[model samples]
Target: MSQEKPPVPSGRRRGGLLPNARDIKAWEEGGGRGLRGFLRRTIRAYLRWNRALLLDPWIRYRPAVQLLEGQTGDLQRTLDVGSGENGLARFLGREVVGVDLDFPATVRWSNHPATLLRAIRATATALPFRDGAFDTVVSMDMIEHLPTGERPKALREMLRVARRTAIVGFPYGRRSREFDRSALAVERDRGIELGWRQEHVLRGTPGEEFHDEIIRTVGAVRPEMTLSWFGHEGMRGLRLRWRLQFLISKDSRLYGLVFFPLYRLHSRGRPKHGYRRIYVFKKAAGGKPGDRVRRPARNSVRDPD
Candidate 1:
């Protein structure tokens, strides 16, 4: 039987920032043939179990909690822009309304019961909320999915609605390129070996460009808005893990036994290049409601991670 193409969201021709319906459909249809298919499914299940058991709680959730420590201000009400399955609402422990183009259906297969309860369907460029509606706004791993030109608009909208602060995090600099390269390599190798190709559609924006645009956008809102930046995760270590994770997932049970410990040890350390960059913007003191701040001529100094 021929595979049916996944339907795109109404009024939108292409997929959103993250993996969309089409990507999920492709993944579902791309299991290997005969013995290969059975082995692939078995391995995938083990990997999924590992991710749910260890990776999510330790690698992702813990880091996010650590990143937000001493950073979140006035968490009374918050907005999570481009929130996918694992919404920030889970972490904040306060009122956090999540908005995304995909929202409740972003994950495709499984329902995010908790996230759906508070998530609304909306786009980052045009958030459906009143000015200063949220005390703090947070967006993670979402901005780079947009075209370079649209990122500023999204950042501006986040700032416009934030009464006190806005926090944004994304892969940065050489790290972004390395991720894309490793991902593409894995996909290419999989297609050659299993006759299933997974296409990555989004373009990556350099940290420098993203950083500059963010600075300009925030400055335009409140020229005196204090911007603090934090960088984390060594770039080389991240690249190595990305490659190893893909290779190990093929025979997860056997390789995982060996890979897991080395993965933990290798992931430790500081490097000259950072994989992720987090930006926190605070409204300037004595700034009125509608003040327009001019963009600074040079980039600001970096803060410790």
Candidate 2:
């Protein structure tokens, strides 16, 4: 079967202040300015603060506890690569180490920045830890942002560092062409040229005012298939409010808040091709002949390479 292609742009419009440049500089220096910089900082802060009230209590506290009920026989050390300011360590208890290049402004743990919750600036490709130092390693929604070519080395590093298990998750699947047609129509009618253009950021020219990220209202994730499906609505012709009724209705809110634990209970340890997915790998103990291993031959831009 042919692999389904996700709708992520192949080449982001490049020019003044590329995405990687901003991220790398911010990662190393921890300082950035301008509206974009402020937006990034603000988003980081919001994610950190909402970690406890929204993410932790809902997914980390109860669902994880129940899912790992029998499997927690011997979990001493857990490491979270790219933990960011999510407060995953606090919810995972003291044994967990939350590693990230940048530390959050605030954390829930009473202990100061110590050995367990060390916040070191490090890259995924070159992790600064000993082999087999962690029992479990986990990363969520992080792999996609990495350069198209660097994922395999990073995956190998995650596998190398973890003795027991590793779990990785990210978004997948294509954007619906149906949605695009309607969306682009609106821009045409308004005399606005929408979508990405290469010349928008030519050298010596001021940056264009075109929007970078255009969100299609019809896209959604099917957790079972890990498929991000788009709708028939094109860019100009979408009935945005009416079509997104499911998301805005009280039913969705209630189901999300009240029935989330039930969803977690049913979905644990069951790997489905969702519009997003969490991939898990377990390391075999001792020199087992049947154990599977992988190494990189070259740096390339292949998915799951």
- The best candidate in terms of TM-score: 1
Minimal lDDT window, size 10, model 2: 209-218
Candidate 1 structure quality by residue, lDDT tens digits, 1-305:
99999876454357455333454334445597797476557555755654443432133333444545565446557788876656665554444688887744444213234432367888899999998898778887777777777888898898889888787876677555656666666666766432211211246644676666776777667565777665546666656766676666633444555556655664454333566566777777776433433323343454222
**Runs of candidate 2 exceeding 4 Å displacement:** 1-52, 56-74, 109-117, 175-271, 291-305
Global Cα lDDT for candidate 2: 0.45
Encode model 2's per-residue lDDT on 14-96: one tens digit a residue: 45333433453343344378875675675455334433234322342333333334456566677778776553455555556
Clashes of 2: 19
- The residue pairs found clashing in candidate 1 are 223-293
Model 1 residue 192 CA deviation (Å) reads: 9.2
- TM accuracy, model 1: 0.63
Clashes of each: 1, 19
